[model samples]
Target: MKQVKINRLSDETSAQLQLLTIKDMMSLLCISRPKVYELMQNEGLPFMRMGRSLRFYAASVQRWLIEHEQVRG
Candidate 1:
């Protein structure tokens, strides 16, 4: 298993440090597989390639969501 170095956060947040698979990413973002790939390729979604598989850090993905979130008027 590949290891990811995570910055220390609050206890609750730190506990969530783990790698997420593509399926997990799809579910977490509530999007389709193709869309996830699109985001990874074009939308700057953070990810790492582990051999032939793609992995995402849970906390990083959450932070990305927060950073990318837009307040629609």
Candidate 2:
């Protein structure tokens, strides 16, 4: 099983911070490696580069999901 970190903050900005591996993203988004890279390139998915690695922000991704569902519906 994979693990994600939990955070507590004020009601106005209480967002959990999570670091997902490439493998974890594959499972969560149910997309292939190529697709993930495509989204990273074509779509403005929030991501950060640490050293030589890329990481996504959980809060930003959650916001993206909410927007996606709104558009879909």
Candidate 3:
């Protein structure tokens, strides 16, 4: 008998593994379309260029947001 290992992902991990489109980013960040492009260019928002289309990973975007968050004293 052979034993195989199974890899499992938590619910939160699975949710964070999604690829977000421009419209998805706009809705998620509540920003305009142009703003999304500006962030990708100037703000160093993590993304991948697939042909002519841009794709953002949910986890990377969340991480970027957290890194850029400003705290008011």
Candidate 4:
């Protein structure tokens, strides 16, 4: 997994920030809502449930992306 340093945010959110909403994940991956959901079900996308919403960790998502690309190749 590659290290993801969010240098844009200087506030406290820059550290120990793991959870990301579906919308945020969509933007980072540059994909649509349906595509993200499809990956979640088909691929082993590490995630968590915050009440009724779904969340993903930045590091884990980065790792998953790496694994996904490897699989594609």
User: Could you say which candidate leads in TM-score?
Assistant: 3
Model 1, TM vs. native: 0.76
Number of clashes found in candidate 4: 0
Q: Candidate 2 on 24-73: residue-level lDDT in tens?
A: 67788999988878777887666778999988867777787676664434
Compare the candidates by lDDT and give the number of the best one: 3
Clashing residue pairs in candidate 4 are none
Q: What Cα-based lDDT does every candidate model obtain?
A: 0.89, 0.74, 0.94, 0.84
- Model 4 residue runs over 4 Å out of place are 1-16, 70-73
What TM-score does candidate 4 reach? 0.70
- Show pairs that collide, candidate 1: none
Error of 1 at 1 (Å): 33
- Superposition error at 34 for model 1 (Å): 0.4
The full ranking of all candidates by lDDT, starting with the best, is 3, 1, 4, 2
Task: Residues 5-73, candidate 1: write the lDDT tens digits.
Answer: 977688776656688999999898799999999998998999999999999989889889999999999
Ranking by TM-score: 3, 1, 4, 2
Give the CA lDDT, 0 to 100, for residue 70 in model 1. 93
Candidate 2 collision pairs: none
Q: For residue 66, what is the lDDT in candidate 1?
A: 93
User: How close is every model to the real structure, measured as TM-score?
Assistant: 0.76, 0.68, 0.78, 0.70
Question: What lDDT score goes with residue 9 in model 2?
Answer: 70
